[model samples]
Target: MKRGAETRTERRDDAPRDHLLDRLFRSEAPRLARFIRKSVGNQDEVQDLVQETFVSFVAAARTGKLRTPEAYLRTIARNLLWGRARRPQHRDALHLPVDEDFEIAVAPEQEWMMEASDFLRRYEQALAELPARTREVFRLHRQEDLTYQQIAERLGLNVRAVKYHMRKALLYLDSRVNTDD
Candidate 1:
């Protein structure tokens, strides 16, 4: 067999038999293994998890229940990693009461996210109302990290025009953002 070639085997017969799966495996195996190794932190077990993921994929493909190859592989890797974590030996490695010194934190919930989303909407609305050239000048300065002189040079405008655009953008944003708050 040539280097990097897959060896056809009988175990793969039960699956729906797509050449794409072989192609995907060859192309994605290294990346899949790296992702698993990052989560599990075990150099030795990384290849094992990747193999098990493919085995699961073959089983899933047999059932005609496959989705995107990358997503399917990720789901399988996650399940296998969680299974490893649930083992009795590993489970008991942490038995704890609360650590008062280090408080457990909760993920940000819906209201905070909604407020942020609303703010972004208002900000976008404000930006959208700016004149085209003025908006471009402001974006070049802020987003592209260009100085006023550089922006002026790029847009073929004088430095005073660039500064005027910057001030205009800032004032509009300030008015909109403050009123919204």
Candidate 2:
């Protein structure tokens, strides 16, 4: 009613968006987690994904673009869940050139060559550093096309021991392998 005084709607419209997000998180988090858990089957990751959903919703809400906060949040959550569902399969899916009609000339840079060389050296070093038996079992099984039973017979060891060493070698290599390269 007074000049220069904000109306209730104006005050609410200008309120810090985080407070609204916090309120939404406090209220809807459990429901969202339960909803995600039914599909994801992991409680710990469900909470994290729900939090991520809230964060994305907050970012969108901060722009003051939503007409219905609750509905928008649920929609965002569903989309995030859908994306998660597709992520693993998508990564392993075969990726081909989008523009197959175009022939793009490609060349590796000197930096890339150097990185590749360094990566190979590191990989070799990691393999060399494994325990002798583990390295031998891994090399025999992977490089020599020998099965665990064959390696065990050749090495005069139990098949179980050969398997255990192979597993250890593989785990070690997996931890050391440079997937990015």
Candidate 3:
């Protein structure tokens, strides 16, 4: 009983320290995110860097090497920014905070939507290879965003058949996608 009481006391002491760390980290994240965003010009990419920075800081802290955590974090952020600036343009890099290039690349009038439509068209073709009932049910639920019961009522089929068709369609799609990859 005495040993258990001591263990509980130790845990109580550590809990507040953990809570403090959580609060500190949360406070630091938004500031870091905004700094990266203004410096690099991509909000989404800044979010990624903030996550990566926190992960690295946690790892380093775990190993007892964090003497000045804020300074360490700033050093990591600067290095990441510099490295991103130096990377080649054509590399298939993960998302990095980039300036006007990102805006131009992601504009709606550009090829992004066209490429997405092409992929969807291919998916529809693959879906059509299914039986008529399966394809119709899957399309109503997925593409047209109809509920299962709605599809059942509209098609005059039982709900169970609709569910079975959806299941088979999903399996077929999974197999086809894995093979294509």
* TM-score (all chains, Cα) for each model: 0.41, 0.40, 0.40
Error of 1 at 15 (Å): 11
Error of 1 at 65 (Å): 5.3
Residue 107 C-alpha lDDT in model 3: 47
Q: Give me the overall lDDT of model 1.
A: 0.73
Error of 3 at 97 (Å): 25
Q: Candidate 1 — which residues are off by over 4 angstroms?
A: 1-18, 93-181
Best by lDDT: 1
Which residue runs does candidate 3 get wrong by more than 4 Å?
Answer: 1-17, 89-181
Tens-digit per-residue lDDT, 1-181, candidate 2? 6744667667777676657667877888888887877656457878888889888876776666665666666767777765664454422333347696867443333333345455656778889999998899998876555678889999999999998998888888878876665
Candidate 2: where is the Cα deviation over 4 Å? Answer: 1-15, 89-181
Best by TM-score: 1
User: What's the best-to-worst order under lDDT?
Assistant: 1, 2, 3
Q: Looking at model 3, report the run of 10 residues with the lowest lDDT sum.
A: 85-94
Expressed as tens digits, the lDDT of each residue in 1-181 for candidate 1 is 6432443445465354667778889988898888887655557778888998999888876776544667667767866766665455543443347877977553333333344446656877889999998889878866545689989889999999999999999998889976846
> TM-score of predicted model 2?
0.40
